[model samples]
Target: MVLGRQRRQIMKILIAIDSFKGSLSSKEAGEAIKSGILRVIPDAEVLISPLADGGEGTVETLVEALGGSLETVRVKGPLFQEAEAHYGILSDSQYSPKDEKLAVMEMSQASGITLVSPEERNPLKTGSYGVGEMILDAYHKGCRRFLIGIGGSATNDGGIGMLSALGFRFSKENGEEISPIGEGLKDLAGIENASVPEGLLQCSFQIACDVENPLYGENGASLIYGFQKGGNKELLSQMDLWMKHYSELVKEYNPAANPEAPGSGAAGGLGFAFRSFLQGELKSGVSLILEETKLSKKMQGADLVITGEGRLDEQSAMGKAPIGVAKLAKTQGIPVIAFAGTVTEGAKACNQAGIDAYFPILREITTLEDAMNKETAKQNLADTVEQAIRLYRLQHKKQ
Candidate 1:
């Protein structure tokens, strides 16, 4: 019925778009969209809520959404070196109680592949010890609810390093404690859980994940994602076997651990560690972000919602932010449109995924390198959005 209303009566528009990755930040992208909407209807009430799917921009997006600040902490890096990592804490929010602080973290900050040099990117050498430290840092600051994005990793340690940081020690058959890493898993004779941080069990974690790879196998972490982290074919085979051994050992410590579940292979097996050890729940990243940001409430009485990402493709339907936003708006009977830096081959699928229509930001054929230039991306995004809105208004002209 809302869609049936006249264009003059539909004043509010919601813009919940993710970052353009290399070109624009979430806030910047949202601003571009807002500018576009304002160009068509200068007095329109456009609400811009920048978003991310628990990935690199998660902290900034959530902090901006919930009115919080980023807190920096010193933590161990993937290579056992000192590293600085940041997490966002929602000190206050319109939705959350003042007493409760929600933390959003991205594991890639401290243990991402980009942090390591290409030559030193061996999965066997890197670890996720820093990720656990980030959690502890947030926990010490009184954050009990964690929204974690577990994408972009530099290790295949099966999360041994993270578990070690949280008080689970890996010992060899000789009772000697060993440093946790992918190769070190071969010596994982036993695990000591007595030293795990106290009150850790009281915390709850919601992992933002999109993949469904299991812990170890052809489709698992090592086989699928390890090569990008410097694992050769031979190293991948070895790491896979070690991961199997590590999972078996972990099962001995926690009988309920299920490493084969969907998303268990994410971030070099950090998904398994969180699910099996920390008792975390894995969910679609954009969905979690939507709930945290109270998108539905913000969208109330809106005539249209616009969302976008760096690209639109078949993968957009696989838990991408735009499609997620579209699906939410669909439930409210609101029409949704998306704009992307480039509309790829499979982008037509978005129509079936709840998006009423979509458009590409680029106005002319150009190299990806050229299209991603910050100024170019911004102008293209704004121009495309303006034209799209003009077309939308034309379609709804007095019948």
Candidate 2:
């Protein structure tokens, strides 16, 4: 073994991560990861690539990895008027002969609930129309496939706005119809028109989700996630009922399906709209990202891999970013450690998912925003790293 003769050989360190929401971007995650690495292994060569799980910061993550520019288009916001939203069109892959390329969109950027203020959060009026607007623009620009992130939505309008943009129409019995907001759905006595764009179905959709909630009735979008989007008790009931009606109406025409299908309620029932109406496929967003970025290859040669998210708990074990990274690391028999904003009940949930250990960066109850005073948090994490590494060295030496 040449283990004793490796001086001057670079110890390769790869920093991959997701954004820490309101505190840092995915790019910032890589920076922090690199900082953590340099603190322990100053001689190691660092490779930084901020990873995204196809939700909130998907566009930025892809742009940074692909070394591309960002573009913003004015689209309908969660509210009524148009707002500028950002997406990235990556440079063509090295193998492709085409001059044009695909554009990555974190649809939440245009249609996310964050756009609505506390004073104006009416789930009845919000819709994914804005996201469709961005998609239509990208389509005109010759993008053939879309990498769309579909988390944190403001509307539970069942993606009526999205279909409308693609030339599908939902109508009422009185011979006229309005837009596809919750309020509009109640008026949706029937769907009179569906002029789906020709060849639009040919374009591929990569939905970044693993949630399996059905589209209507209990355990569906309105009953489960609607309140967070500002559905009142009455409105929650109404939206749930209206979604059922919409489902029943659509199923009559499609015949092969209805709304109770798994993953039909993801992102405020947009999953149903995409999967049923548009013939889109549902997939695990984090896994797709790891594959697209070739993260397994990067993790192969690392001595240790560190990954984290806003929270580490049972949920994290179920297809979260850090777990995805840990699973990949464990496949190569590499040690994986996780740092998180907090550890919830049953931290043991992560044991089987290939997480070697979990570390909560915060010791006391505190606001992550305030505690994120970078200098202090950095020192705290760095100190923890040193202590853990020291303990590891001691145990290994004895063994």
Candidate of highest lDDT: 1
Q: By summed lDDT, which 10 consecutive residues of candidate 1 come out lowest?
A: 91-100
Error (Å) of candidate 2 at residue 322 is 0.6
Global CA lDDT computed for model 1: 0.87
lDDT (tens digit, per residue) of candidate 1 on 1-399: 665666557578899888898898888888988898899989788998868887778898777756788999988888988899988998664645556778889998888888898988888888999988888888888888888999989988988888888888899999998778778888889988799777887787899998899999999999999999998998899889988988998899899998899999999999999999889999988888998888999988898899989999999877688888998998899999988888888998999999888888888989989999998998989999999999888886753
Q: Find the number of clashing residue pairs for candidate 1.
A: 0
**For model 2, the run of ten residues with the poorest summed lDDT:** 91-100
Residue 65 lDDT, candidate 2, scale 0-100:
65
Query: Which candidate has the top score in TM-score?
Result: 1
Point out where model 1 deviates above 4 Å: 1-10, 95-98, 363-380, 397-399
Residue 326 lDDT in model 1?
Answer: 91
**Pairs in steric clash, model 2:** none
TM-score of 1: 0.89
